[model samples]
Structures are given as structure tokens and as C-alpha cells.
Target chain A: MSIKITNGNATDEVAPQFSAERMVEVQRIINQYPEGKHKSALMRILHMAEEDFGGWLSVPTMNYVAGILNIQPIEVYEVATFYTMFNIEKPGKVVLEVCRTGPCMLVGSDNIIDHLKLQLGVEVGGTSADGMFTLKTAECLGACGYGPMLQCGKHYHEHLTTEKVDALLDAFRKEHSTSSNN
Target chain B: MGRKLLLEHVNVPGIETYEVYRKNGGYRSVEKALKTMSPQNVVEEVQASGLRGRGGAGFPTGMKWSFLAKPEGVPRYLLCNADESEPGTFKDRYLMEKIPHLLVEGMITSSYALGCNQAYIYIRGEYMWVLEIVEKAIAEAYANGWLGKNILGSGYDLDLSIAPGGGAYICGEETALIESLEGKRGNPRIKPPFPAVKGLWGCPTVVNNVETIAAVVPIVNDGGAEYAKIGIGKSTGTKLISACGNLVKPGVYELDLGVSVEEFIYSDEWCGGIANGKKLKACVPGGSSVPILPANLVCKTAEGTDRLMTYESLAEGGFASGSMLGSGGFIVFDEDQCIVRNTWNFARFYAHESCGQCSPCREGTGWMEKVLHRLEYGHGNLRDIDLLAEINKKIEGNTICPLGDAAAWPVAAAIRHFREEFEWHVTNPDEAQKRNFGIASAHVPLV
Candidate 1:
């Protein structure tokens, strides 16, 4: 696995930082904890930082987060890698997360995953050549009853079928093409 | 037709809002607990209700709450465990999504009862949408004066916030949850310094599952004894069963505990029977962690008594012939579904979520998944089955947390109940590779 940080550099000179508006929100999050214990805000801030600096937490980004919390850079690195959600590398513009755990698999998630791979022309955890989509499998996102689900951003597409997957991919392609052209 | 305590107002329009929920008697428990009942009185009532933890372990909720260490000048915290990552469980998510205020109401009552001035809800990061719903509900509570300083003028200042776990299943464990809450990796801590005594920033803390906290709403409203009257002995009150996989209607159903397992499977009101006119092959009654049961054992115990959906009844024959009502995941398998493949999927999930804290769980889970993978792909001999069982035995009680046992039980149960299926894969590798062996014969509706 290649640990590619942002700008292809892991040195301290990178000076990773969040945007101005996000820094204010980071302060609000830090205030949620007691004094001398602002480290509790590290995860929340990392989540925001990941959102701020694309969808992945680069090494510089992790170091910046550690700086905000007055903790060691290793603190942020340990947390970023420990969580499956935090991506250290750049992903495609649209990341398709399909649930392939027991319940989802029991209800045909495997077929859905295969369908996604074929449509996007990318294997699992592989990014599309056009940098439009990335296909990844999730464990279980608590949509067991509405199995065969996938999450894109905050929305969850549940009770999925092949037809639904096709429509979703088409819509995402339109979305990606439209957004990128701007 | 069963008593719907938590979800009674779920379908009522605008119950997601504070005004509508309050109008529908949503926070009556908060009012009752804060105004009429003493702190100890509230604990005693919950103790009388016999409500057990709904997050798989089946520990008595009231007993767990009573264990909170209340040292002088030390603030207590009540953390709501909304990290519903278990494969087959989605009931908590349903409750939070549909009726968010119900949880907020329950949290207020629980916080008041435990003398907690501040509380937090540690939800899984994947439920980003649910977090918004909960945050909106919390905002509504503050507007309605149900939260914050001097709530309802009872001089009880309690604040609730939502924390998102950074996508780690091990964080669902209490100590790991506390560790994650402190902004670190979610590694389970050693016992003796249990969360009750030392938790979340070295303060006395109590972590309750979302459903368990939501159940407190009805427990306080109906009184502890009255709430206990709803279900069978010890497994009192209604449970939210999240049924999925090969069911006609895969959704969350709130059922009284004493309902028969057969009825739950086939009743139109519950799972609505298996889908596509297929036969019931097997089931994981609880979440992914519990032992999987064959069709026959699911409906009736080893001694041939009709099995009910209570905690005790589900564990009827111990691990040998019984399963658990763990987290009420209730995953049903149709005749065509392959047990070897399904078990492999669960093993893979465990291995992915092992936290790498213990050697047995980290190493054993990966080994089990690999062996199961080989068996499923028709690359295993007959001895591999015994090897898988041996792996489960070594992993069962070796880890610091029950995750080790959780990973082992399903593998052991699958082999015990379906040994012939394994041997078939070994002896007839080519044929096994060709097609999956399915259980024949459809089960008639028992309800």
C-alpha cells in the first residue's frame, strides 16, 4: 500500500492546514471538551478536515489536525489509520461504498458489487481511469432490513436492484460530468 | 397488535418534531423521573422492569446502570451507544431515523436518573444522515426547554451531544467507546477499571444502547412492574427485531418478548414468512455474533419445546443446540442461500474488525476466514473442517473482550449444525464448486 500524502510530501515543511471557515468550526468542536483535554475533538476535527481537504486525510492534513489539538502528529496518524472511513489517498470524485457484510451479502450485495465494478470499470478499492468513481465495499451500515444498499455521501440507496444500480451510476456520471465541466 | 411501546407514535405525523412528540406524551418519562421519582427510585423501577442490554450481551440494563460509581464531586456521564454496526441489526437506526425525539426524551430521563449533568450519543460515523436527524432533535429539545440548564425548572442541568465514531466496530465496546470519545484509536481497555468505575476522562460513566435507552421511556411511563408484565419472565418489555435476508418483509418489528419464534418467522405481522416461496434453511436470530441455528432448532428447542423469542428461551440448549437473541438482528436464510459462504462473509467481517489488540482474535479470525474461504471455493479436505473448529476453540475465551467469542460462536455453530454440508464440500469438490447444496422442503406457517 502506497502511503501517498497530499502534494506527495510527508515532511514538516508541507504545513498542512484547514481553510479559515473550517478553523472556526474546529474551535467550536474543541470547546465541546473540557479545558486541558481538547484532544477529544480530534476525531471530529479530522472528519471535517477530511471533508475540507478532499475526501482523504493526507499526512500533512493529519499533522495540521494534531497541531490544532496541541498533540503529537503521531496521535493523528494513529487515529486516521485506525479508522476505515478516513482515506489517506485521493479517491475518485464520486466514491461508491457498497455494503458487503453478511446481511447485505445474504441479499445479493455480491451481485450488486459485481454490477458496480462492471459499470464503473474499476475493481473493488480501485479508482476509475477517468477519476470519476471509486468502488469500495463497506461492512454493514445498519441498513440490514433494507439490504443490498450502498452509501454515497450522506444518502443511502437501499433495497437495491440491478436496475437501481444502473440508474444510480447514470445519475452519478451525469453529476460528475456536469460538475467537472464547471 | 402487540404492544408498541417505543414505536407507538412512530407513524404519527410530526412525531419527529418536539411539539408533536410532546403533544403525543413523548417526554412523559422525563417529567415523571425528574419531578416525582428520586434518583434511586428511578434506578429501582428500571431494575424491576428486567430490561436487559439490547446490544447483544443480554446484560440486565438496570443492573448495569446501578453499577455506576458515584463518588463525591465527580461528575457522571451517560453515553448512549448508537453505533449500530452489527451486520443484522438496524432497529436502533430505525428508531432514531423515524422518531428522533423518543431517544432524546429517553436520554433526558436517563441522564436525570443517573445524576449525569452531561451526556453524549456515540453513533457510528456511517450513519451520517441519522446523526443529522438526532442533532435536529437535540436542537428541538433545547428550544422546548427539555435540555440545557434548569430543564423544566427541575434544577437539573443536563446537556447532550452527538459524537461520531470513526468507523471502527470495536468502538461499540464500552471501554473502546470511552477511548474513542477521548479522540484516540478505539482499542478496548482492560477490566477492573471498568467504565462504571473509571470511564470517559476518568469519570464514572454508563453507556446504554439506543434501544435500551428508548425502552426507558415506556418503563417510566407504565411503571417498572407494569412494564415487566408485557414480556416473559426476565426478558420483560418489547424488543425491536430487525429481520432481514430472504424475508417477505424485511423491516424492524417491535414485538413482545414471549412471542414464539415460529410465529415471528412466518406471521404476516412479523417477517411475513420466507420470500419467493422458498424453504427456511437457517437463521442468525440475533446479530452476526451469535450462533446460527438450523431451521428445526430455530422453531423448537432440543427437548422439543416450542421456542419463544425471549433471551432465556433462545439460549435453550446452550451453545450445542441453541442460539442467542443477540442484538435482535434476526437474519433468515432461504433454501438456496449457502451457509459456508454466509459464515465466510461473517468471518471476513470479524477479521476486518478485530482491532488487532489480541493475538487470538486478530490471528484466529483471519485463519477462520481463510479456511472458510478455501472450503467455500472447494479447495479444502475433510480435516479442514476440524481445523476450523479447533481455531474457534482457541479464540473463544482468549481475548480481553467478548469479540473473540463473538467471532468463534458462529463458526462453531455452523459446523455443529451443518457438518454434512462441510464434508460434502470436501468430498465432492468439483460438484460443490458447481452448485450450492440447499435444504429442501418448505416450512408451513406455524402461526
Candidate 2:
């Protein structure tokens, strides 16, 4: 549950001392907790820093979050590396997770993978030359009804065929280019 | 006798909302619960209802409620375990999405029954949209005086929140779920201090599945005796089933217990039939966790008659014949489906989802996955099948959480029926890969 705690206690606002703007969000986040136990927000701080610093957690960013939270650096490091949801290194601007579990695999997921590689010139876990899309494989995105699916920035693109994959890449380009035009 | 277990009120949508629900006699239970009956009555009503947990364990609902240790003036809790992360189980997710209010109303009525001032719906982090609906429904309940402080002028105060889990399948375990609620790593605590005694901030909590709570609304609405009149002995009330994976008409189906397994597949209301009009090969009858049953056993009785779908009926031959109605997730496989490959895939999923809490599960799951992966990829041998079965036996009742059993059951069931398939995979590795199943290639070497 994401509660809006506006009247949170004023804790020590620790920053990474790397980027000034990202350090501010970390401050407001730390402010939501009471002082002395700032370590409660270590993972949250790391998550925010990673997203703010271009889609992945750098080693220092995890270290910085550990510093801000008054937690063991290894503790933060361990958490940051443990979860598959979190990327340790820099991720592509658009990280696409293709569903590779049973249902998807049964329903022509291989063709979708081949399509992604053919179009993006990248294998699963590799970024395209333009750094626009990084293809990754994930186990069961829970969209079985829409097997052979892909997730682009929290949105599900399900029921993919070779044609659908091609069109999907085009749509990605069109949307990104449109956003760029603005 | 076939009874209506899951699909008692099918002709209605929005069964969660108060108004849409009220038309078909919904919150009347809450009204009756508030006006006349005491909390003990509500508990007794559930005890009479004979509703099972539906979250795989099939523990009796009333019994679980009675287990709460009432020591002095400590606060009790009702945590709705809506984290339906079991493979092939999507029933709870649909229930919450389709009838958020049904669960909310159930929570209100249940909280009143349990004397719980605070309740939480620990939803899976994957279902971000579900959290929105649940939170909104809770807000509406608060606005309508169904939640928070003197609810419906009954002078009972309650607060409800839905906390999202950060993608750990093991977290669905009650103890692990409690740990996750405290914003800690999702890992199971050793029992003895079961959630009933010291759960959720070290207070007594009754963590129930979303379907379990939703059942409360119906159980309270119609008297428990009436609910008991519906299903067979032990397994009372309807059960919501998410029947998928190679079904002709795969979707959510609610039906009464004691209905024959044949009827569930043949009846139009349920699966319709297998894909390509193919003969059924095997089924994970319950969620992904249950042992698989070969088509012959699934379609037969211990005495060779067609098997029924009741709890006892399915368990006629014990582990060999039984497949749990776990999480109400029924995954079917057609004759063309390879049990070895399918078992391998399930093993890989369990390996990935293990929270690394217990040594047996953490290490055992990984090893199991590797062996199954190798087998399915054609590097398997006759001994590999026995080895996998041996490993499952080792990990079976030896873990802190049911996750180990969940991981083991599929392998055990698959080997029980398809030992020959494992032998074939070992003898003809190329043929297994020709099917394009990629458990072998899925091996991303550990750093």
C-alpha cells in the first residue's frame, strides 16, 4: 500500500553527493521517516536513486543509499543484486521482458524471440545498437491468456506473433519518436 | 451428489459491490451480523459452513479461526492473503479485480467476527492494478461507514490496508507473508509461534486467502447450515477454479464440491474439453503445486470407475491417485504434452521463486531444476528419473514452508505417471530438444 505520509518526521536527509536533483528526492523520502533509524528506507532510497540515475543501480548508487540510510553497504549491495526486478548495471531506455514460461513457450514464444533478435539486432539481455531497447527473458508474466507477450515499461503487449513483434517495434519507435518531438 | 461450490451466484457481475451485491442479498449478512448475532455466532456460523482454506492447504476455515490464542488485551488481525502467486492459479486475482467489494465486505464482516481492529490485504506486487481497485474499494467502505471506527453504528472500529509484495512466490506462505508485511525480506519463520498466536506486529492474526474471505460474505448471508447443505461433507460451499493450460474454453469456473471431475471437463460451464479435441494426458488438478495425475487415473476410480472431483474422491488412492484442488488452480495437459518437459518447467519456476530462506528448499530447488532441465534437454537417464524422485522425497516434509512440498509434488506426480517419458528423454535427447522446450538452454550459469 502506497500511503501519502505528508506529516512524516524530519529525519537526516542523506544524499549521494553525485547528482544534486536525485539527492533531493532521496531527502524527501528520508524525511518521511524519523531520525536515527534512517536505515529503514535503504532499499527504497536505492530504488529511487537507480530510477533517477538512468534506469539502473551503479555500485556507488547502492553504496550511497547504504550511506544515507546508515545501513551496512554490503546489506544494500546484497539487496540490490538479489532481486531480478532490479538491474545492477545500466539498463536500456526501454527494457522489454519477453514471457518465456510454459504457456508462452507453448504458444510460439520462440518466434517472438527470433523476431526481436532479427529486428533489434540483439539477443535476450542485449541492447540494440541505438540503445533504444534491451531484450530480456522472464518466467511467466502471469498473462497466460495473452501468451507470447512482452512487457515494455510496465505495459503488457500480449498475444505476440512474428507480425505482432515487428509492428510492436515500429510502435515503440513511433511512440518514442513522437515523445521526442514534443 | 453434484453441488454448487464455486459458481453459486454466476448470473451476477460486480458481486463485490454493495448495491449490485445487495440486489442478490449481499451485505444483509453484515446487517444481521451487526444487529443480532455476536462475534462468537459468526465464528460458529463459519464452523458450520465447513469452508476449507482454498489456498491449497484446505484447512477448515472455522478451525483456523478457533486457533487464534486469545491472551489478554492484545489486538488481533485479519490479513487477506490475496497473493495468489501459485502457478496456474489466477482465481484470487480475478475475484479481487471483478469483485473487490465482495472481498471488502467479507473483510468488514470477518474483522467484526475476529475482533480485529486492523486488517491488511497482502496482494502480490505484480498486481499493481488490483491494489488500486482494493484500495479504492476500501476507501469506499470507509466513506460508507463499512470500515473505520464504529462501522454501521455497531461501535466496532477497523482499519484496512493492502500491502503489495515485491515478487516473491514464497512470500505467499503465511509466515513469509507476515515478514513481508513488516517491510522485511520475505522469508518463512519457524512455526510454533504460528500467525494465529504472534502474527503481524506480534499480535494474533488470521491470514486468509481472498477466496476464503469472499466466502465469508456468502457464508454469513445465508446461514452456515444452508451453506453446509450445498457441498459434500468436510468440503462445504462453492470453490472458484481457474482452469487453464490447453483447455478448449479455459477461464474461471465456480462449482460445488463433490461434482465429478468428468463433469467439470465435459460440462460447458467449465473447461469444455481439451485442445485439438485431444484426449487428456494428465492434469495438475490443483494449482501448479499438486501432484499430476495421468489421464487414465484422472478418468478412473480406484475400482476403475470414472473418478469424481470431491476431496475424498480424488484422494481415493492416496498420493498416487490424488491431486489437490490447491489454490483452486486446475491446469490441464493434452495427450500431446510431454510430462517430463512440463515437470521440468515447473521445477525451474520453483527454483527461481524460492526465497532462499530454508537450506533444503533453497539448495534443493536449484539442484532439482538443474537435474530436470538436463533430463528434459535429452541428457536425462533412467536413473535421473529415480534421482529426481529421490530428491523430491528428501525435500518433502522437511521445510519451514509449503514451498518445498509445492516444488516436490509436481516432480513426484510426473515421475509417478511418466517414468517412461523421463527414460525416453534420456535415451533420445535430440527428440526432446526437437520439441523446442528450452529448460537446458535456460541454464544461465550462476556467477
Candidate 3:
């Protein structure tokens, strides 16, 4: 699996730093733990780093987070790879993590997954040719009642249909285009 | 119409807000516990209530609290396990999303009872939106003087914060939750030094489920004996059942424990019967980790008794002829649904989520997933069913955490009850791909 860099063509050599505002947020998170245990802030910081560093963690990004926690880069790498939510490699602008567990499967999530693949012109875990969408299957996302669901960024789109998926894609494409033009 | 303790005011508009929640007798538990009742008194009330852990294990909540070790100058902590990742369970998320303050209030009262000033709600990352909702409620709580220093002038101080986990099902286990809270990989620690003795950052800690803590509000408000009177023997208090899959009404319902399993499935007040008017093929009454029961075994017990929703009732005949009320994740399957495929799906989930800690769970779960996959897709022999049973045995009792047993049970129970279905998959490979083995004709006769 090749890593796709979402930001400027910077490799692992690039050292990413949180903006001044995010630094304040980082300090607040660090303060939530006891003294000398700022390491407790690693997971939240890694989450913030993923968001700020173009939705994936590169080696340098992980190292930067380690530095913020005053821990080793290996510590950040171990955690970032352990959790499924963290994207170790750069994904497309939008990643559709569709739930494919038992309950979701019982409610036709398989059909939803196949439909998403057909619409996106990419197989599971494959990014679109245009680098617009990445389709991935997720375990039960705690939204079993509203099955056939996919999570995009922070929003959960549940009780999905083919039409809703199409509309979502169109809206995402439109949103990206408008934001780029701005 | 039975009873609702946690979600009683759920439908009230703006109940998620502090003012609205307070107006609806929300923080009365906090006031009552802090002012009148001592911490031990609060603990005794919960013990009297007979409330079990709502997260799955169904351990007594008050007993778990009484086990907390208190040494001089060592601060204790209370962590709420909000990581609801079990395949068919979403009740915690529903409870947290709809009534955030119920949990916040429960934390305050529970924290005061535990004599701990600092607590945290370790929520799964997928519920980020719900976390924000809870954080808003926490801020509302702080503003209203229910949280922070010397709350309500009772000379008791407490601080509560929300910690977000980066998506791992094992973290739902208390030890793994503490490890994750300390910013490590969510690997389950071996017991002997349970979290009650040595927990987060080496302090004596108590971890309770979101629903378990939220239920404390009613226990304190109504007294433990009153709370105990609501449900059948042992399995006291109302439970939040998140019903899904092939159900006419697939959503979270506040069920009074001991409701008949048949009524819960067919009554309009509960699941309202199977979807498309189809006959029930099978059901996983609890979360996917529990044993799967066929239609005949679900509504009635092995001895021809009516199956109830209580922990003891649902688990009447042990794993051989019963299932658990685990986390109240009621999953229904209709006639057309395939048991082999659903079992494979669940195995795949456990495999994907195994945390790769203990070899039995880490390796055995994957092995089972592969074998079940081949069986589901119509490329297996009769011996493969026994091989699955073999794998289930190896994984069940040989792990540091229950995740291993959880992964093993459904596959074991599926094969035990539906061996005919597995054999049909092998005997008629091509047909199996085209259609499911609808309801199994060879159900074990009730004793």
C-alpha cells in the first residue's frame, strides 16, 4: 500500500507543528492529566495532529506529536497504528467508513457497500482516481439501529440508500469545488 | 408503561440542557446524596437496589464499588466506560446522546459516593458528536454548580472530564480502558491487581458503565429497596435495550427487566414483531458476543418456561440452551436471513477487533473468521464445522480478557444449534451461494 501525501509534496523529512491556537488546546488537554503524566495526552494530540496534518499521520507528524508530549516517536507510532480511527497513510479528501458488522450486514450494508464501490469506481480500501473518495469498511460503529450507515469526517450518515449516497457524493464534490474556488 | 429510571425524562424537550434537566428533577439525586446521605449510605442504597453492570458482565454495581481500596492520601478516580463498541450494542450511545446530563449527574453523585474528586468519561472516538454533546452538558453542569470545587456547598469537591478513545473494542474492558486513559495501546492487563486495586496512574479507581452510573440517580432518588422492587429477582432496575435487525421497531427502548422475551419481540411496545411479517429465524438476545438462539429457544426456555429479559432468566440454561442479556443489544433475524453469513460477519468483527494481544484471541479469532468465511461462501466440508468448534475451545478460556470467550461463544453456539445449516452449506455449495438455509427444521426439542 503506497502512502498518498495530502499536503504539499513533503516527505517524512518535513516537521509539522500545531498552530499557536491549537497549541493552547494542546496545553489544555495536557493539563487534564496529573503532573509528569502529560503522556496521557498522546491519543488526543495524535487525533488533533491527524486533523491538522491533512487527515493522516506521517513519520514526522508522529514525531512532532511525540515532541509535544515529550515522549518518543515510537510511542506515537504504536498508538496511531493501534487504533483503527487513525489513518496512518493519506486517504482521499473524503473517506467513507461504512459499517459492515452483523447488525449492519443484516440490514443490507453489503448492498450499500457494493453500491458505494460502484458509485465511487473503486473497490474497498481503494481511493478514487480523482483522489476524491476512499471507501473502507468499519466494524459496528454503535449505530446498529440506523444501519447501512457510513461515517464521513465527524458526521454519521445513517439509514442510507443509493439515492442518499449519490446525493452525499454530489454534495461533497460540490463542497470541495466551491471551497477550492474560494 | 413498565418503568424508566434513566430515560424517564428522555422525551422531554430540552432535557439535554441543564435548566430543562433541573426542572425535571434531574439533579435531585446529587442534592440528596451530597446533603443528606453519606458516601457509604449511597453505596449501601446501590447495593440494596441489586443493580448489575449494564455494560455486559452484569456484576453487581454496589459490590464493585465496595471493593475500592482506600489508603491515606491516595486519590481515587471514577472512569465511565462510554466505549460502546459491541457489534449489536448502541444503548450507551443512545443514552448519552439523548440525555447527556443524566450521565453527568450520575457521575457527580457516584463520584461523591466513592469519595473521589476526579472522574472521567472514556468515550469511544466514533461517538465524537455525542462527546461534544456531553461536553456541552458538562460545561452546563459546571456553570450550574453541579460540578467543580465544593459542589452545592456540601464540602465535597469533584472534577469530571471526557476522554476520547481512538477506536478499539478491547478498551471497553476496564483494564484496557485504564491503559488507554493513560495514553497507551488498549491492551488488557492481566488481573490479580484489578483496576479496583491498581488503576489509572496507579491510583485506586472504579470504572462503571455509562448506563450503570446513570442508574445511580434513580437508586439514590427512590431508595435501593424501591429500585429493587421494579425488576425480577437479582436483575433489578430498567435496562436500555437497543433493538436492531429485521425488527418492526428497531430502536432503543427502556425496558423494565424481566419483560417476557416473547413480548419484547412481538409487542408493539417493544420490537413490534419481525419485519415484513416474516417468521423469526434466530435471535441474539444480547450483543453478538452472546450465544445465538433459534426461534424455538428464544421465546421459551429449555424447560418450556417463558423466557424473560433478566440476566438469570435469559441465561436460564447456560450456553447450551440459553443466551445472555449482555449489554441489551437485542438483534433479530427473519426467515430469509442466513445464520452462517451472520456468524461469519460476527467472527470477522471479532477478528478485526482482536487487539492482537493474547495469541488465542489474536490468532484464533482470525482463524475462525477465515474458516467461517469459507463456510459462508460455500466452500467447506462437514469436518470444517468441527474445526470451528475446536478453534472455539482453544480461544474461549485462554485469554487475558473476555474478548476471547466473546469471540468463541457465538461461533460455538451457532454450530451447536445450526449444524444442519453448516452441513447444508457444504452439501449444496452452489445452492448455498444463491439462497440462505431459511429457518432450520432441526431445532432441539425443549426439555
Candidate 2's C-alpha runs over 4 A off are A1-83, B1-26, B437-447
* Highest-lDDT candidate: 3
Give every candidate's TM-score on chain A: 0.88, 0.74, 0.92
lDDT of 1 by residue, B204-258 (tens): 9999999999989888988999989888888889999999999999999999999
In terms of TM-score, the best-performing candidate is: 3
Off by over 4 Å in 1: A1-19, B434-447
Q: Interface RMSD of every candidate?
A: 0.8, 3.2, 0.7
- Tens-digit lDDT track of model 3 for A28-119: 77777777877877888888888898889988888777766767778888899999999999999999999999999888898899899999
Whole-model Cα lDDT of every candidate shown, in order = 0.87, 0.75, 0.89
Candidate 3 stretches greater than 4 Å from native: A1-13, B435-447
* Candidate 3, B1-447: lDDT as tens digits: 567888888999999889899999989999999999999999999999999999999999999999999989999999999999998899999989999999999999999999998999999998989999999999999998989888889889998889899989999999999999999999999997988889999899999999999999999999999999988889888999999999999999998898999999999988899999878889998999999998889999999999999999999899889999999999998877778889999999899999898999999999999998888777888899999999889998999999999999999999888888888788877776654334322222221
DockQ of all predictions against the true structure, Cα-based: 0.76, 0.25, 0.77
Which is better, 2 or 3, measured by DockQ?
3
lDDT of 1 at B330: 94
Please give the C-alpha DockQ score of model 1.
0.76
lDDT of 3: 0.89
